[model samples]
Target: MSKLDALPHGPEFRFVDELVSLEPGKQALGRYLVKGDEAFLVGHFPGNPLMPGVILIEAIAQLGGVVAQSDPEIAALKNLLLTGVRGAKILGAAVPGELLEIEATVEGRLGGMIQVSGRVSTAGRELATAKIMLSGEE
Candidate 1:
């Protein structure tokens, strides 16, 4: 099983569709498969479908958080939790049945928290970007 599959999240909560690449302290690439039957799509504007912004951010957080926790410094802390997100920009929309590639880069670290930036794209078009923050846990 992949490292992501071993995590606590499962099913719909597992936003990462694929683990494309990982370069410590540099970047991490992941993929997500948007499903037509996704729970949010049902009431998300009905006929007009768009992936929810929160879900988009969550995917970024998951991808970035994985990178942060992998660091020996942060990993030594035992647990980690996503504390917040900032500067989230949804440049385009990702529709159901689309495959998304997410890239997260480490920006810096502060105390028990780590900062990262990420972008999600497909077909050479940008879907969303965000500055993600995560905190070391007990």
Candidate 2:
């Protein structure tokens, strides 16, 4: 199975489309294409249809998970949980028909807990940023 296939999230909830690069426990880069017909977009803003900020944060967290799971030891620990989100800032809105590029870097790790900082952008412009924390089950 591909690395993404190992993640706990299913197709509908999986935000990561392609893993561009990864540095085991250090960092990861991924991308997703918004096709404008996603189920969640139907009522996100009606006419405007902006991609929600929470989804972007989730995307970042997923990318961070990709990085965290790259380590063999962490991958063995399933069901990683998101412990917290910090310093989240929404600078702009991502619309349908755009390509979302995300990157996450490991900030720290203690036992099964990992801290990561990440950002989401489209067309090279940053749309949001946050620090995501994930704890592996011991």
Candidate 3:
């Protein structure tokens, strides 16, 4: 199974399209394609649809969750959730037809909480970056 299988999101909510590389607990790289048919795009900007910053953040967090759950050294936690986000910056925007490259790395861990740093980029241009915290039942 793909490392992304560790994530609990359904098809509609899951953002990462493919896991390009993974280092179990250490890090992961993934990709997503903006298809323009997403429900949120309908009202995101009628004529000029753009992916929301919040969704971008969610994508990062999802990848983070995948990284956290794949750690062989730690017991997998149940029901992993994105509990916090810090220093989130949206430097650019993504539109339909753009492919997003996402990268996340495990920064540290405390009990059932995992801290991750992540970024979203496409065509060598970074669109967003953030440090996110994920918690799961111990």
Candidate 4:
């Protein structure tokens, strides 16, 4: 059980709404829903409410960010950046009213680069999964 953060997203790009739980690299989960006022979704379909693939990737990255920021292994690093998304898949689509449960567990860390693999689910159904990466400040 975790609560959402009220961080101001740059532009209209708020990817996540909550910080469910984070345990360094071991595990992390977060949640979010589409904001009606979001420009991207406003005309994404005009009538359909699909959480886009890019947003899903962002949600995963956000979780990865939290892990990097909290993990003592990389906490002292001034900056942490989510460096990649697989970029070749749409595991599934998340609907507007669905509560997404995104979970991540650290898979490996090489030097300052950390990798976390995770999945996104809506009501117990997996929507998407990916291996996200982060790099600490040099």
How far is 8's C-alpha from truth in model 4 (Å)? 8.8
What residue pairs are clashing in model 3? Answer: none
TM-scores, all candidates, are: 0.88, 0.94, 0.97, 0.80
TM-score of candidate 3 versus the correct structure, residues matched by position: 0.97
Name the candidate, 1 or 4, with the larger TM-score value: 1
User: Which lDDT tens digits does candidate 2 get at residues 1-138?
Assistant: 777887788899988899998888789889989878878898998998888899999999988887887876554456787889999999998888999999999898888889999999999899999998998876
State the lDDT of candidate 4 residue by residue for 32-69, as single tens digits.
Answer: 76555567766777888677877777777767666655
Q: Give the TM-score comparing model 4 with the true structure, all chains together.
A: 0.80
Check candidate 1 and list the clashing pairs: none
Output the better candidate (1/3) by lDDT: 3
Q: Once superposed on the true structure, which residue ranges of model 2 sit more than 4 Å away at CA? A: 72-75
Every candidate's lDDT: 0.80, 0.88, 0.94, 0.68
Worst 10 residues of 4 by lDDT: 1-10
- In terms of lDDT, the poorest run of 10 residues in model 1 is 71-80
> Candidate 4: what lDDT?
0.68
